[model samples]
Target: MSARLEAINITCRDHAASGARWAEILGLEPEGDITSANDFITYRIPGTEVYFAFQPPDNGEVGDTFVPRIHLDAVASGNTREQELENLLTRGMKLVVDARTADGAGWFTVEDVDGTQICVGRSDEERAAAKAAREGSS
Candidate 1:
């Protein structure tokens, strides 16, 4: 049987700092403190069951270290896109770029504290479709 994913673990130079950054960026709540006994801090994103664990680098050469190749995508209400984007910036995310699609939809890319790129926002059409789906279901 196939299983569901629960959490994603990432390595950084400092787990606590990374965890704190992620907590603020994603509106998550960290459950444990990163310590010598447990070198990880698990942060759970609210309204979801997923968790993200941040830890220190594994054994390797000075220059050879864990570089995450993952990217995260999130959807926001069309009207709240600007507010959410501002919140992400306030939480230490660096904006890479922002552009509008041919259909006049907008999207942006930002880098997290660990340099992991995350894409937030959606095209205007996509936002409208999502809203329509939600309203139809309700």
Candidate 2:
């Protein structure tokens, strides 16, 4: 059996606010309540079958707490190279890693309001070339 990605759980200092930010970024409407005994809220990216959930930080002082590292990577559609970067920036994303090169290659790594790192990339020509190569091999 193979493992599949279904949901990602993120611990945020402010779970509700983090949920709202992720909902806006993913063009989704969040559901659930952090105060409803569950202490978490979820945002689902429809048609993609993926869910992002925001939960309260671990119970303890920072020095005694364990925070898990969480990062996600995604591919953007339409345009090439910097279009996803522009869209993310317009939506108030903070740039973390400037992976773009002078030769017009590479991708980007950005952070959300809750400091969740997400790497996004778009390259039509490169993808097409790779697809063609794969098809040729097939």
Candidate 3:
């Protein structure tokens, strides 16, 4: 049997703050009480079965050596890529990398408040459609 993806658990020094920041950035409402330090806060990406959960460190401390290697890739929704990038910046994400293709499709890598790198971009289909629309309008 094939295993299905469930949830991505993130260890945070301050789960509440990280949860709040992520909720605002993703335009998602948190599922659990962010104020409760004993429980994890979860955000389910819209139109998907996947979930992102933020929880405090198990040892009650996030050491200086702790560095996250995994980065999340998210598609832009409900807004243009530029608008989404602007929103991310306004919500306190630091810009890391911004790249684009000749067709005007692009992606941005931003570091969240908790220092997790998240790449936000458009899909190949979306890029093709956008390019077609632009050509038609010209």
* Top candidate (lDDT): 3
Model 1 CA lDDT for position 126: 59
Q: What does candidate 1's lDDT look like per residue over 10-54, in tens digits? A: 767666787888889889886765454256788887878767877
lDDT, model 1, position 115: 82
Q: After superposition, how far is residue 109 of candidate 1 from its true place, in Å?
A: 30
Cα shift from native, residue 31, model 1 (Å): 0.9
For 1-138, candidate 2 gives per-residue lDDT tens digits of: 111244567776666777788788879755555446257787777777667877777783234465755666565655554777777788888999988776455678888899887776555555677678779999
TM-scores, all candidates, are 0.42, 0.44, 0.45
Ranking by TM-score: 3, 2, 1
Candidate 1 residues lying further than 4 Å off, grouped into runs, are: 34-38, 60-66, 69-138
Q: How big is the positional error of residue 66 in model 3, measured in Å on the Cα after superposition?
A: 11
For each candidate, how many residue pairs have backbone atoms clashing (under 3 Å)? 1, 0, 0
Candidate 3 lDDT over 9-120, as tens digits, reads 6777777788779878988656656566576788887777667888777666568855434456666665656667788788899999988677677777888887787777
- Candidate 2 or 1, higher TM-score: 2
TM-score winner among the candidates? 3
What is the C-alpha RMSD, rounded to one decimal, of candidate 3? 12.3
